[model samples]
Target: MSASDNKIVNQENKNSADIITWREYEALRNEMRREFRTNDDELKSTVDEIKQTLDATNVTVTGLSDQMTDIQRNIADMRLAIENLTVLQQQQQEDDDDPELEDDAHNARGAPRGHRPRGWVPLGRNGRGQDEEDGLGKPKFSIPKFEGGADVEEYLTWELKIEKLWSLHPHYSEDRKIKLASSEFDGYALRWWDSLVRNLDEDGAQPIRTWRAMKEAMTSRFVPTNYMRNIFDKLTLLRQGVKTVDEYYMEMEMLMQRGRVRESLEMTMQRFLNGLKYDVKGIVRHYTYTNMNQLLHHAREAESQLAEEAKVKGRATGAGRFTPRSFYSAGAFDALHSLLYSA
Candidate 1:
């Protein structure tokens, strides 16, 4: 082969190699572009998913915020309720502790200044009429007024009524009990209480805080010194006379109570027996009795038996059926005889 032919072949070979390398480079560039486009598309898809996740997170955060706000409001309302309940309990405690009748919002607690509350007879010093309801809008139990009187029995009855009032409604404090009792006073009784209070205040003496003290003061003022002596004298001189056993017993019992007598059961029984009529006392003395009740029972039975015997005797003699004409005078008898004949 000639050197020139060889050179031409080498050149052709080089050219062919060059062309193959160029084609391979172009293919590689195209592959790289396609890969880049695919990567870009995948990145864009990831970005869209991230944006959707962010939007969902925002919605969740908003919902959680609203729930937190509601929880806070509920907590606030619970706190308010607790505060109100505490206040109510405190108020109730105050009402129960106070002793004096002071004015409050409700009528049940007390009366207005210097006046009696509902259901109680007011002092009427302020010229107010009786009230039906107490401070708390509840009806009060009616208590009778106590006007001072000279009769010891009347005062005792009034005092007994006052005691009964306390027993029925026992929640009163010591001071309140005294105040309530005084509130029922009217006329002379009211004046007496006012004077007592004023005198004590002026003398710088301790106020009457107890019912016992008030009762003592009242007894001293209303009851005469010789009242008990008079009652005792009447009791000592008592006799059954023409009265029945029950009537005699009642009179003796009243005298004892009025004089506040205290004696042994035996002595009391004997005293009661001694007061009975001769026949009744004779029978009762012979009976076996341990107490006054037994003695009285025996006495009453004896009296009843005697009465029955008398009634039988009168019937047997026709004395129970006697007419007025039997006792008429001679002149009266003639008038009746003439009138009957004429008729």
Candidate 2:
């Protein structure tokens, strides 16, 4: 009986111990699973936060890049503008250094050389004149037919007809006409016959006022003093005769030598006549007036003496005694007469 009881008790104790150990192992496994789940959740949260921070940093970098691009564009534009301004300034400086450019700019701006562009009409050789061209390339005024018979009487008759026609106009006063005629004749003083005649044809009884206006207009067209004197001499001859022309020309030369006539006239008839001769044909005519025959002879003698003096002195002759640079060649005079006298 004692051996059976001992065996049963020992078996029961062993069975109880095994049951307790199994229970403890199950509890520990459950706790470890819970702890692993908590740790995984925390790691996921930290990873999410880091990802958000990275995204924000990327956006900031992108924005900074865009701002840099805009700044670069602005800098480039400023550079281009500065370069253009620099080029323009350089070109202006270059133009300032050039006299021809200055002249061209002045002409383009409608500033005259000595006189205003309005009062004096530019004439060409062959009786052609230049007028201001309109935008359509047509001249502002047409050239008038001024050539008539070569007879002085015929010219005078035409002039009288024009004078009479002018008289009919309300703007033309008889007193003014008489005064102008007298002034023209007197101004010519038997020297500037051709100039006188031409002026009469163009201006008639308004020589003083018209010529003065022309001169005023020509203020921008400044010419050399010697050139002015030559013009005055030429104009005097046109108005009067060669004798007066020579006298005036000589007087002007003397004045120039004495420095008395420096900058006397800003513009002169000779310059106008030269321009006309170069531009217009038939504007200036050469003829040996019977009244000027003696004067011409004396001028020839004086010219000869001047030439001889020049040869002896081994220097250039005075302009008055020398052949005219612009007009008054023997051949030119003969040609003019032929053209005038030709039927």
Off by over 4 Å in 2: 1-23, 104-343
Candidate 2 lowest-lDDT run of ten: 131-140
Stretches of candidate 1 exceeding 4 Å from the true structure: 1-140, 151-153, 166-173, 319-343
What tens-digit string does per-residue lDDT give for candidate 1 at 1-343?
A: 9999999999999998776577889999999999999999999999999999999999999999999999998997797688656644543444445333333324533555766455444322322222312212122566678889777777978777888877876654455567677777899999989998999989967678678899889888888879878888999999999998889889998888767789999888888888888888887777898987888889889998899999999788895565776757446778879999999
- Give the whole-model CA lDDT for all candidates, comma-separated: 0.75, 0.47
Best by TM-score: 1
Q: In model 2, how large is the Cα lDDT of residue 99?
A: 56
Name every residue pair that clashes in candidate 1: 106-135, 106-136, 107-134, 107-135, 107-136, 108-134, 108-135, 108-136
Compute the lDDT of residue 271 as modeled in candidate 2.
28
Note each model's CA RMSD in angstroms.
26.6, 29.5
TM-score of 2: 0.27
